[model samples]
Target: MVNRFKDPSAHLEIADLFAEHDRSSLPIELGVSRRTLFRYRDLYVHLIETDEELMPNLNAARQDPHFQKINERLGHLLDRYDSKWTEMEDSRAEAFYDWVPEHRR
Candidate 1:
């Protein structure tokens, strides 16, 4: 019999697995790559941020220990990139101005 948990289309379920387990081990458990796990997380965050109908679920996720751990890991990754992003902003100001209208700049 085919295992339902191994369903390839179960993106959300895989995301929940990532949230509840050690991220390093989840890829092996789910039989997917770390990159796939990251994509699931990005999609999950997009849903939480943009899907108004999911607010209740989002609130529950926020309270979940695994969710919190995933969130913290993402936060740290963003923090690590923030400095480089700021430097890019400084270096790319001319390019940004060239691309953006004066009113929007």
Candidate 2:
């Protein structure tokens, strides 16, 4: 079942999974790759910021009985990327962008 939200990009992957009656399995159950799932979560976060209508659905997702399990799984997946990002940043002391603005200069 299609969720009734207006964002087409999230309609299938994110929204439908969060819908009240869609009956689709959780993202992990669907064999969604970790990177793809992260992309979906990022898209969902953007939608939550820009589209207030999604808030209710997001809240529902948060309150789901499986929320804790899902959260743990996502967190575990993110830990690898987080560790890599930290390591990369620590490896370089150079500022990523070092241009001084005209006024500051």
Candidate 3:
């Protein structure tokens, strides 16, 4: 069983697993007990990567009044840096011109 809309070859990992199980388990195909298919779900990656910085970024976005005030101050500081960017841009004019054209797109 595959979804009508999705390409099986494009989803090679999932398609291969289903095909392996179907060949071994389908009553009409193999006439035997079917093994359950599973995804290689490494759920620990996000849990493992959580750190001191993640909490601060999330806390800022959560927008509690105190955090929101800090977020506003950070935004103001960023705007100040942006305002002073012309001098920095002049210092790195060639690199900045080349880099920013790609980024702005």
Candidate 4:
């Protein structure tokens, strides 16, 4: 499914959050430097090591196919949020530009 997420960054950050499971199957698509992805992977492993609660949730959520659907919907809404952000950016002017020193140009 096309990710509907608002922030593309979420694709990575969130995927990493779910990585306690093998959710690496889904992949975190947020644009990342290879180094950052590796770092997040390390962080995920650390979280899994320290937290007992996350392990079961990972198992439970993975078994539920519905969680995949939830991920899709979450991505979709995030896309909408991105769209709104674009719209807002398009509508903007330098509201404070008038306060600038002309000589600063």
Maximum-lDDT candidate: 1
Q: State candidate 2's TM-score.
A: 0.27
lDDT of 1 by residue, 32-104 (tens): 3333232332222221112133334444456666656775654433332224443212322121332657899
Candidates, ranked, lDDT: 1, 4, 2, 3
Worst 10 residues of 4 by lDDT: 41-50
Ranking by TM-score: 1, 2, 4, 3
- List clashing residue pairs in candidate 1: none
Off by over 4 Å in 2: 1-52, 79-105
**How close is every model to the real structure, measured as TM-score?**
0.29, 0.27, 0.21, 0.23
lDDT, residue 11, model 2: 33
Residue 86 alpha-carbon offset, candidate 2, angstroms: 19
Model 4 lDDT tens row, 25-81? 422222111212222311211112211323344445554665566555444434432
Q: Per the 3 Å backbone cut-off, how many clashing residue pairs does candidate 4 have?
A: 9
lDDT for predicted candidate 3 compared with the true structure:
0.31
Residues forming the 10-long window of minimal summed lDDT in candidate 2: 42-51
Error of 1 at 30 (Å): 18
lDDT winner, 2 or 4: 4
TM-score of 4: 0.23
Span of ten consecutive residues with least summed lDDT in model 3:
42-51
Candidate RMSDs in order: 15.6, 14.8, 24.2, 17.0
